[model samples]
Target chain A: MATTAKSRMLTGSKAMVEAIDQEMERDPRVFVMGEDVGKYGGIFGSTTGLFEKYGPTRILDTPISETAFIGAAIGAAMEGMRPIVELMFVDFFGVCMDQIYNQMAKIHYMSGGHVKVPLVLMTAVGGGYNDAAQHSQTLYATFAHLPGMKVVAPTFPDDLKGMMIAAIREDNPVILMFHKGLQGLGWMDQLDASIGEVPQEPYTVPLGRSRIVREGNDVTIVGIQMMTVHAMKAAEQLKEAGIDAEVIDLRSLVPLDRETILRSVAKTHRLLVVDEDYQSYGMSAEIAATVAEAGLYDLEAPIRRLAIPDVPIPYSDPLENFVLPNAEKIAEAAKALVNM
Target chain B: MATAEIVKEIPVEKARWMYETMVKIRYYEECMVQAYAEGKTPIFNIGAGTVPGEMHLAAGQEPAAVGMMAHLTENDTVTAPHRPHHHAIAKGVNLKRMTAEIFGRQSGLGKGKGGHMHLFDPKVKFACSGIIASGLPPAAGAALAAKMQGKNWVAVAFVGEGGANAGAFHETLNLAALWKLPLIVVVEDNHYGISVPKEASTAVPFNDIRGVAYGMPGFRVKDNDPLEMYRVSAKAVARARQGEGPSLIEIETYRYLGHFQGDPEVYRPKDEEAQLRKKDPIPRMRNWLLEQGLASEEEIAGMEARAHQEVDEAYAYARESAYPQPEEALADLFEPA
Candidate 1:
């Protein structure tokens, strides 16, 4: 809504760091801690120019100890310090899940409201540039399945900044997952939509909310994180093919905005859920279930889902792209549903 | 390098407290072994029991916990590994709540949310993780918090010798040393990590010497002697309290039980456990206490009886407590906004 002709356009990475910087300046208790988050400015550029401004006390370049640093973030948060800890990649959660899920997620609940952990766990997700099974994964569904943690993924620069500020200010632990493909990094093929006009002042887009990026009535196409970008493109393609599609970006997964999704299905009477995470028991399924339970009478056709199959994301570009949801896949799925 | 002499004498009251705590931990673990066996008599179904999960009993590792914890106060913090009962008991965690948690009762420490391996008692600043070597960083973080807040409070992390090889262990040591955090890393070298011996898993023979690589003084307690552990930890605790950074201490301890309650322990030699039992730290400390004139036999017997009574009361409390409601599973997942 702040976008204007004179507004400055920023990349997703710069917008994320700008939000963190503004918040750090606002609150002395806030700090950054993670591997390569200092001098390297984060492997994905999430913390660029922060270390030089904040110094070592604020911008801590930690060793490659995901378990220790992340766990330490939880400890610091419990002590009333707001720490923005990075896990480098979402695929590496396996090494430090105890600290993330068992400790960070459960400490507030385990303490029975006596202890409150206010921290933002930022991590890079998704893969398109042949990083293989280990480096490339968007395990958003895995974190959402577990209780006690708020999970969010932003598509554009503005939402990334607002949601990040909102995450840093939240009382509970929040996992801010950013996709690599949408980060606008120089090495990877970036999306033009990933760069957007961001407000200079710090703002917070509330969590647990969904945004209607494109509105139509023929079919409802819901996407999460990076898939939202693809859905917007697919909506354009569907228009050219004589079909009107509605695109919804689900920013938060834990407190899923089921009402917005149900309303879209009601108007469209057809549904297509797109996700970059695994197919089974993921966001796609959850969206389908949401529509089936509350908006079953509104649908004229069965909900179709486009996502990665239940297999390790291969290193080959063709294999990886084959499984990943894209504009073509979303457009195809929406056309099929509309025809039905 | 010269070895530090064990010249500092532990006070009579402190020695007695350690003895009683060690006795209490031994009895509690012994009781757990029995409690874990209930309802699984005909066939060993791990999921079908009063304590329905894998139970790791720290029966022979009491000295490592009591020695280090004796130097800590309630304000200090402790993060422990999967085998954490001795550490929790030594750190003054409430007995009734811990037992109820192990029994998955509603009155438990975590309200039956965290079981034996995942016990967390913030009142005494005690927490443990089921993952190996996972608690080290949090301990360092707590120490960092203490330093940042200008508190003299120190934090201790307990891990197994096998866990010493984990990346979390090394990373935390570096962080603690670099930041000058009041942290002490204690490794209970129980000779075996589950089924694999230390030789097979660890690159070095002693984890203590690895501290030198991280610019911290490391000491190895040769035998599982409570007095020796106390002597080594005294220096580390004093150093940490003095703002002299972290220290690593590895105590050569013994594990009497299998890795878990149901572990067959096929990899262990038949006579290995029996050999380790001959040098049990409990009786060794009892004899040392009597020889040093720190406690009388009557006092020792009284302490042992008191420990048994406490364990009995805790078990009763756990058994009498009720299970949480079935729908309560959805509760506690998130804090109410």
Candidate 2:
């Protein structure tokens, strides 16, 4: 876009790693820690070379004692340090929920809001990695349900860089989730480790802004993380049939851009939300219920949602295909909502 | 920090002071129990328990408080477990205000919000906690802060025998050992954690062995004599103040009163409680002091009477203090998030 000649591709996680590495070189307090974060370059290699650059104290290699290390991070943050703690997988947040929900979120409020713990808890969430039931679950619903925390999941590489840098700078505690299945979906990563196409320098995209990736008016389709990729593909399919549909990427959940969603819905008049998590009472319901409560008269038709049914996300090709909402399901749902 | 011995035995004046303090604690607790039966206090105790008559191990645990605090300079921090009243007195947390705190008066440490075990006087380095084993890492954090700021200060954490089983205790010890933090962990093993025996709670025979596992030098002092706890704690204080990291002093003592005011004597065996009482550090150390001509019986008696008088005055002061205004309950509720 900036008249670049050598634009390339990269994975979202790899982009995050490069951004963190470059930031670590620039700043002193920005360091990473977790199981195998150092030496092992992180479990999924999300933190490669972080340990080598910073020694054990700065780039600590903690034991599997999540509660202790997380508590230690809280203390460290209070005592002036910006630690980027990796949860390995986000589902394990349940293990140290007390430190996350009780301490990290409430410390500032309890200290009469005198304390500011600038910390980032980065983790991989979502299913389809065959991470089984425990590791594959998406608990953003639990985090977003709470008031004090902010949640961000980026679908593209440039977005990851922007969100992460913002998360690091944010005075409040932020949870930046990278779904395991959407690692390299965008051309932000190349087969080689270089971030050739990503914006050369670091920058921040303000939280709670929805990027309207495609312009249309017939139906408004909302997608999150990996689901956004599918929603765009489905919008392309809808265009061939002359059914113009708007594709909105809901980038964040906590500081959710509801005003943006309402603006799109006012023009489109129909809403179709596609989520990879379970369909029952998930993000889809949250959005649908809020829209209904806020602008019941703005809707020309009932909102439609595409999500995995109220069941464990299946791993088999056919079963997973049947349960999960994809481009085909998004198009079908959008067609039904527009037709209504 | 150097682990050198205190270099001299307990002098006569200090022995009398220690004996009188212990006696005062014992008598004051017994008096509070009597007052409770006479309708002096309400049921809403500060530490999620009863009022008055609720003291535990105050008789045997004084020397650890006195000795551990003697070495601290102005900038050091100290965190205490539930039975923290002794530490409060030893560290100069205004006895009248502390007494007011325990009685749930408006002039209390947390302005009546936190009571008994929750004393929080930030002006002094003294803070209190009711959650068992919750104070370790923060204490280590203070020591880390002292190190970072280039100050010659240390932090001390005191807990009971059973608290060593908590993950907080173990992790703090490991981290202190790893960083060689200037801290002293005084394990006031008064034979029991509330009503559960230490043997029932821990697989390890003694807390000293557990301390050894964390790679710190441990002292299993048979502090059946209060003077011995003072002597051992002096060495620990020296080591910590000199920046030699933490040392664990397991003072094997006993509690004479019931766990709390209302707890019946059903859990403790009759003979077991009697055996522990016989080994109570107060009288044993008293007789030792008298035998060694360190304190005359009159001197010890006078100290005991003075401690009781002090307690009586504290009770009077706490009673006269006005109740906190209703709106004060919501005050200091949030710092600002």
Candidate 3:
């Protein structure tokens, strides 16, 4: 039986652990498999008690062979099991890409849409401290290149837990990328899926849809993961400038709900996309281009975007701050847009 | 057929299977040689092709295949190299599909996409790879998966002497040994990889020593002798089934044909092919069967004739079968039903 929870103070990372715990308890098929996830309590401490509580078999400790384990997970997924594999770091995905792109994503399309790989690839992304370029990267853009795959970036605990469950329930292969920078924040421990709210029973959050966390009428803000927090802060600053901004959390990128985005763009007639990844070929660029193609004529002004410069994320705090998009940067971009 | 009926006639049945397999491979290669000379298949210019100037055959390695694969179960997996005839025939790949694959027909495995070196028959657990040691890790993964699922299955990877000399083989073996994975490395030691002799490629005096490097039991068998190969491979296969870890069984074989079907034998001496032919395992097994009163000369000849006729018919069938259609090319590219 799942351990039911009400109000409790938990970090975002801890919230993810509790969510996975409750998920494993709710469904017998749901299991966690990854390297050192069993004995090490996760490199981020997200899964502290899980290994001892669930045993090593269900919470498998794999070899450093990412390709092998990923392929094994594909086979396991094909055989009717929901496997959530934790790639120690997002960069390690390069080693097991064949299983991710060729086998998992293409399984349904390749099998003539016969099989569904219900796999959740959870990996830690983004650079905050000195982990270097390899360990910390927003490589969700890499996944977005492929078809038949979903990319979910959750910023809050409740949304994180909900989106994680929704990703597991998805019939296609889904990549749930976690930014290392947004490790601990806040979320509802228990979520109700049926009514898009806290239910009397277990439930999940909807995918492919945007959440309007903060609403306005003057302009629309497309917030990507950590950018949402920055966007909210930017909105508070923009309020003083008499510019109201509607902030949208783009939960799932691939099956992006264009209706919601176009509706916001229609209401505001101006869009400002904020992302932490590199500006070139980044999510900001993708969203800006998508809006132009979909609602080009409806726009009163050209779309503006705020993102990290197209360079290796710097090591020093001074350099890194300039490299990544922050609240100040978002405010500056939004202020510039409103002034125009 | 049940194990009892199968084992009762194991010797005779295995020999017959060996003879028929040899005939299938021989005739298939002969057909490709003719087709290659006729310019029916295209030249890849660099890598991959069964067409003229791009193919490889196992003319003398038939015994190595029949001997080893004779010990396999349908549930077990087989990892093969580019020169994959022996494994292809041994794994029960349809003669028609096999020839079509060599012919670069749309009817081939991978639907003419992978062609010769890259055959993937999920129904029979045959995973072919052009990369020398590429198949080892996957086979090791398959074995681990089998063990995890608690299934009585084994995985065999057919590596060449050159690949057995590579690091992938060693790494895969170490991991398989550590996990006690139900896998076996069947090193088909044909002495030469393409043009380079085994000595120039490896420091280990013999390829069989490469087996012990993985901490698993190793064996060297007369690859030209089908029965001996069968005995060695059967023991290993059974041990793997019984939860024993991997084994390295090196079959000291020879390639009667060139490295590839249309390849010139300029690197080796002219009489080498003839010398290897003298140890033809099919006829050797036939002679052993006759002297032991297991089968008559007429029976063996008749079986060979039947085998030849079957191959001829399968080729004709493949030739007459419709080309897989342009639209169908994209189908089954991934895992389409």
Candidate 4:
């Protein structure tokens, strides 16, 4: 007789770890390498319990040399071994951007399709934890701007589990940006969406698909990662005010689901793109441009963007809160778009 | 011009192969220079004809390549720098395909996407990059894969003296040592990085000595003798294969040509190239082979003839090969459906 274990709620970080564990169990070629990923169980606990389960051979703890380890992942991937390389923080891309952009991103293309780099580069992004400019910036837009890489930022626990598994199985190089605010760590504040029921079996929430988390007819609000949580809250507030709002969670940035966005905008007739990354030339602007270029005729008002106002994330809570795109700011932007 | 000491331990068969491989690299470079000149002369333009683009000739570093490459099989991986043709040839990359790649033909290693600087032959596990010091980290990765997969293969990174000072070099060496990865770091100390000399760029007098900081053995072999290079490289390769971790081997050599095809070369003294040519590895190896009774003069001549004929055939094949279609440019950016 088959025994069915009762499903329990898992935090986003736990779900992520479970997903990687399942993939590693399924494929022998899959392995993990990064700083503090072995004994410390990842700074964010995204790799918790992986080291004991997989051993040192698979769960490797690397030195603080991002360039070497990341490049090694690229090489291992090119040799047909799937590697999951983690950058401690998205803000640390400066040390190894060449390996990420030049080697990992362009090698397959530069090799004239002779090679394939199937690797997942996971990193912690966003700032609500009083970490200064260097540690707390959502730089997924910079990665998304680059071609040859698929950038994903999932907020919900289930989506995090699904995307992490999908990224590992992808043939193309993937950058998985996990928002710190959504990780549900005991040390940091958590979101309700972080603790949700995740399926025990392996599954993939296909990339390039935007989920309409909340449906309404007045306006469309788009958010990714941490901003998605704020957008959901903003929608709830807007509903209390009787102004029905729709929210979109953009899971993948490169293979963008512009159809879902445009379709939502065509029905709602308003757009408010919410992003935790910088405002200028970022995901916000990209969404605004996409809608303006393709779905302009369907819009009722000018597209509004609520994002970090092009400044470094400060350590002070008040300063960070002022610049960050929270529910109040997103709700305000949505109300302005509806008023316009 | 006989040296006092000769390495007699190398088998006669292995000695002959080394001599032939050196001859092959020399002939390939000779043919490349002529082909490069044909496109350069008659008004010396950058993108003139046939074999276009500026070339970084690897004419004098054959000893370092041949010595280390002698112990390597097709399963072994090598990451090379801009001046990479010598290492690629030594690693047994298809001569015809490499020639076609230089000619920008569809039958090339990268199907003409990668030029001479970025040659890659997956079958032979040969890869290169144009960026300085960029190859070391990838070679570490290749070694990491070999270790993780329980394979006996090792990855050799061919860097220059100047590249040893790079963050990529130090970081990769440290990681390789820490992980006990099977990586052989070869710094071909040709004493020049384009116009700048090694002394001006690097703090250390020797590159191999830096390996001490990473907990790996370091050795320097002076003069470009194939046998000496082979002996030192053999120990390093054996240490790596036995899971003893990485080693840095610096080969003292010189470059006969300028860094690139059209380089004005105002940095070096006028007699420097002529002086370095006196100790050229190719002629020295040939003389050593004769003195050691490894091969007859006629046999040496026959090896040279075969090298010349092979390069000539490769050039002809490249010349007759078709250029990739314009739409083909958009094809290789992603995998085929």
Highest-lDDT candidate: 1
* Model 2 C-alpha lDDT per residue in residues A116-210, reported as the tens digit of each score: 56778888877754556677766767788766667888777777777888888777788888877666534222222122256666667776687
- Candidate that scores best on DockQ: 4
Global local distance difference test of model 1: 0.89
Model 3's CAPRI class is incorrect
Write candidate 2's Cα lDDT for B1-337 as tens digits.
Answer: 3345563666566666666666666665665566445543465453443244344436546667766655555467777877787777666666677667666677766666666766655556676566676666656656665655555677778888888888778877887777677777878887677878888998988887776787888876675555566667777666766677878777676666666656677877878767776667776777887799887889777777798898888778877887678787665533323
Give per-residue CA lDDT, model 1, range B1-337, as digits (tens). Answer: 1123333988788799999999999999999999999999989999988999889999999989998888889889899999999999999999998999999999998788788987888889998888888888888988888877787889999999999998889888988898889999999999999999999998889999999899999989977888888888888988888889999999999999999999999999999889999988889889989999888999999999999999999999999999999777667766676
Chain B TM-scores across candidates: 0.97, 0.87, 0.90, 0.96
- The docking quality of candidate 2, as DockQ, is 0.18
For model 4 chain A, the run of ten residues with the poorest summed lDDT: A1-10
Pairs that clash in candidate 3? A12-A184, A110-B335, A110-B336, A111-B335, A111-B336, A158-A187, B55-B261, B56-B260
Return model 3's CA RMSD, one decimal.
Answer: 5.3
Clash pairs, candidate 1, are none
Estimate the TM-score for candidate 1. 0.90
lDDT of 4 by residue, B167-237 (tens): 89999999999999999999999999888998899888988889899899998899876788888888888
Query: Stretches of candidate 2 above 4 Å error?
Result: A1-11, A18-27, A114-116, A146-148, A182-202, A206-216, A243-248, A255-257, A278-282, A303-323, B1-160, B166-195, B221-249, B253-265, B269-337
Residue B171's lDDT within candidate 3 is: 63
Q: DockQ winner between 2 and 4, please give it.
A: 4
Query: Model 2, chain A: how large is the TM-score?
Result: 0.91
- Candidate 3's residue-wise lDDT over B1-337, tens digit each? 1221223235677777777777777776677666555534464343333253367778778777888788776777887877887798788877777666655566665555556676666667776667676667667766766776787688888989888766557767776787688888888889889988888988886776766666788888864677778777777777777787888888888888878755667888999888888877767777887887877889878877887887887677657655557786555423211
- lDDT tens string, model 1, A204-287? 999899999999999999997778888998999999999999999999997899999999888999999998889999988988
All predictions: root-mean-square deviation over Cα? 3.6, 6.0, 5.3, 3.4
